[model samples]
Target: MSVCVKGDTILYGSDNYLKIADAADPSNPIEIGETSVPGDIYSITVRNEYAYLADIFNGLRIIDISDPSHPTEVGHYNNIYYTRQIVVRDNYAYVACEGEGLKIINISNPMKPLEEGSYETPGRAYSVALKGNYAYLAATNSGIRVIDISDPSDPFEAGYYPTEGYAYDLTIQGFYLFVAEGAAGLRIFNISNPLNIKQIGYYDTDGLASGISVEGNHAFVNDGIDSLFLIFDVSEVYFPQETGCYKTATANWSSAVNGELAFVASDGAGLYILDCSLAPTLLQSFNIRQAETKMELSWDISSREGITGFKIYRTTNEEQPMTKTTSPTIPITASNHYEYTDNDLINGKSYTYTLAVRDSDGSESVIGERTVTYKLPNIVYLCQNRPNPFNPSTSIECTLAEPAHLNLSVYDINGKLVKT
Candidate 1:
């Protein structure tokens, strides 16, 4: 149905808040522009041409990106200590503030944000996901707290369920709540009755599943360590089955999606955009890919654009990637074309290789597929920072063709900027 594939170009605080790239053309992504934000960007929600960013301690930053090439900050609010997560519906913005509980701000006037109301919880609230008029708050050890935001100016607590451990992140769909419970794995709750929630089902992926995003019948969960998306089939709310799973070029931390594409945020790896129509398609690969030794890699390209070049990435354990190498810019005027042979590869050892194609328009596709064992090099390829039930520091690594701009920052338990 849809023809174009969209990729998420991630930007974070440590990277100065902007990773400007244009992938309108799924194959070759071009760096169009870059700008600076007041705080480290933690979460981003786009409505219309404006992007609402929850920037840690910096509060909510309203940026006008009518022109994606020149994004300018138009407004901001610094009331909350740490703006961990946010959900905007109509004129109201619901924020989950660490120690501040839940904050309701009026953003009718994007420039001047006004505080409407606040509610305190037992533990620190880290993430907030909203569906319809209900706001689901991940209250860490305090569990999953549900609030009725039908009245934006004043949100009232409708109900809550205190889990055994901590609830880190959640995704709401239809009448159900998919929560990423730290040690509890993926907990499903029936919110058909808003006032009283009921646990429906769950599945443990043997790792702390941190960020989650749902589309159609599939719910994608980010496994803290490996390069796999703990896939779950939720056609039957009572029992979710683990479907097929795949990894992105980087460690996938947070996930967002429309009907056709999925945007995954990889801490140091930038944004990974994937196509999820009938069967998931690897759109394009960005960043750099390099190995201690040379290697050969192959991947499928999801674009009709005249493929110009392919980008390759390498790492040691698939956790932290350290090198990137761009090819000599081949032209793909035909379909289902395969370009192979890296030639100069070293003799023994193991290596990881990801293929990225470049389009005539300059947009880049995500790196899909991996190969190891070519005079192996101890390279660091940062996958999405995982085991997200993190008490403090979470392991982060990324693949690079060459070391470019790199910075890793920590936010308070509440999502405020701590350090770089």
Candidate 2:
């Protein structure tokens, strides 16, 4: 799985390579191609279509994936140190070299990736993140080491913070550096003062913090143990807390998101993509009594991203595919409060109904359905309205499939009361 930028797409593989993709649509991804090498791939960096890959035992390899599907190897720089991860800025590539410290390479020319220089660290380096001209090194067991890369060819250590445990991965957003500090959990740092990095707050979970990515006020973390993806609300920097978590299909190594969706990569479970369009789940159906010709329909409100409102649609042809043109929306805000009357609908006609939740981004999730067979008013088969496209009125019956206290009425398109 890969976590790409809002405009750029990326993918990682254990085959000693990484796949750069087009992220135009978060749900449907387009692969640019695969970059290959030897040792297992640990991380990737893509600028335009050019990708920089770090292989465990093979050092750093460069490939041009401008064509995506036919990524070709352009150049490579092999070293004696075990390369774990890397980040590219300007013409320089900063590599987390295990045991030997951090290595910097100049890739101003894709055809010839030249080794610029190397800087020795006090401990093994696991990952690296670059902000401005400064680089944050995830030095395992030694915490986070800040390095000034203003001079790409010769990077020097600026400051160090012992996070109290093994630092596996780190990411930067704004002036904060989030560290995936293994058993110590997630450590948030105030980097407004780069040279004087300070830990402002932290959130500890039972799982080991393996990898992390930050976007806005939210942070997604990969728990090394059981392929768990833990999401936290970092909106409040000083005291961030876990809001939700999900276990991927397999044990995962890394996770990333682009606000609307989350990406998880598992060694055994492959890659799993999730749609987080809703905050709180809503009940699908509502049924009232037989006498109420108009029934009020509502649902729980959600605050998650991409949330819009709710839609009510009808379909007489159950075998045909349900399309947007076939469904009519019933606008709702904080609650799912909508009322429709059926004075014009034939009382004995059978109809099927559905409720669709519309997201702020315009994506919709139509709820699971159960059909309704309309009958005599007093016969009481109170299932919610169907084919909610009523020029004047719609029907609601009640034998009571679900409990509902509804005050149904009729109103014109302009908010004028027609029937009470």
Candidate with maximal lDDT = 2
lDDT of 2 by residue, 1-420 (tens): 333342556566656656666767756777766666877777777777777777778888887776777888888888738888888877888899887777888888878888887788888898999888788899988888888888877889888998876899999989998999888889999998888989987888688888998766678889978678888767556656565788877768776676667777788566667665432234423443334553333334324345555666655553355432322555554554444433333455455555556767787665424356545444445466764876566676545333457665767799999776
Q: Kindly give the stretch of ten consecutive residues in candidate 2 with the minimal lDDT sum.
A: 295-304
Show where candidate 1 strays beyond 4 Å. 1-14, 225-227, 248-251, 275-420
Q: TM-score for candidate 2, please give it.
A: 0.64
Counting clashing residue pairs in each candidate, in order, gives 48, 18
TM-score of each: 0.61, 0.64
Say which candidate scores most in TM-score.
2
- Give candidate 1's error at residue 218 in angstroms: 0.7
- Give the Cα-based TM-score of candidate 1 against the true structure: 0.61
- What is the alpha-carbon lDDT of model 1 when measured against the actual structure? 0.67
